[model samples]
Target: MNDEKIVQRAIEGDDTAFLNLIQLYKIDLYKTGYSFLKNEEDVLEAIQEVTYRAYKNIRNVREASYFKTWLIRIMINYCNDQLKKKNRVVLGEEVLNFQGSADNYFAMEIQEAMLTLDDRSREILTLKYFHDLKIKDIADSMKRPEGTVKTWLNKALKSLREKLEEKGGKVNV
Candidate 1:
């Protein structure tokens, strides 16, 4: 079934539909959680918490079309709360462990540069690039104006470029 249909079913208190919905997005949720939390255990914990919260509050989601965005917002908020509790700051070498092919290494280098940014900048970059979310969806998920989201996205790209240049990497942007 389509996500919207499944979401509608879930909102109607179909336990199986909710479980199916969670299963469908499990990998995305795991990856999103892992981006904030490098540890496997913590990522798993965040996913579990997000799942429970989403299931309990499924009815609160107004639009079935935005189910994924709503779930991601919850996960992001949960991850932020976890970060606050641990007072964790994502350092380059600690978070981006680059061990693989040369292409993967370069990608990891960019990720390391991204780690230098503030949480909000990193988040916008992730949503735009990694998750491939459009500006409108990002703005909605963040509860910010589209213009604000655009400004933040530009700032994030600029900051990423600066960081990359500082590390002697050539940044086109």
Candidate 2:
């Protein structure tokens, strides 16, 4: 079934359709959660919370076509809330260790740099680059104006560039 139809069915209280929708987007949601969270356990917890919240509030999603974005927004919010509850910032070492891959030096540097950004900046960058979301969709998911999203995107890129440069990595801003 098409995503829109599946979402519609989910909104109409079809349990199987809801499970299907979650299965379709599980990897994306997990990756999004991992981007902010420190450990696999935390990421899994965040995903569980997001799933529960999405299931309960599926009816609030106004557009079937935007179900993915809506689901991601919920995941992001839940991850943020978890972070706040922990009241601890994850160090770069911990984040890097979580991946446990030493083969990609460049990716490691980029991930380290991303860890330096504030939550909003990192979120904008993640949505734009990792999720490959359009500006309009990002703005909608973030509940911000397009112009503001643009500004934040630019600032995030600039900050990422500076951090990369500081670590002797070259990236075009």
Q: Each model's number of backbone clashes?
A: 0, 0
How many angstroms is residue 26 displaced in model 1 relative to the true structure, after the best TM-score fit? 0.5
What overall lDDT goes with each candidate model?
0.83, 0.85
lDDT of candidate 1 over 73-158, digit per residue (tens): 78878877887787756543543564677677666668667656787997888778878899999998778999999999999999
Write down the TM-score for model 2.
Answer: 0.85
What is the C-alpha lDDT profile of model 2 across 1-173, one tens digit per residue? 68999999999999999999999999999998887775788889888889999999999998898899899888877877777787776643554455656555667777778877888898888888989999999998778899999999999999999999998856776
lDDT of 1 at 105: 64
Supply the global lDDT for candidate 2: 0.85
Candidate 1 weakest lDDT stretch, 10 residues: 89-98
Off by over 4 Å in 1: 90-101
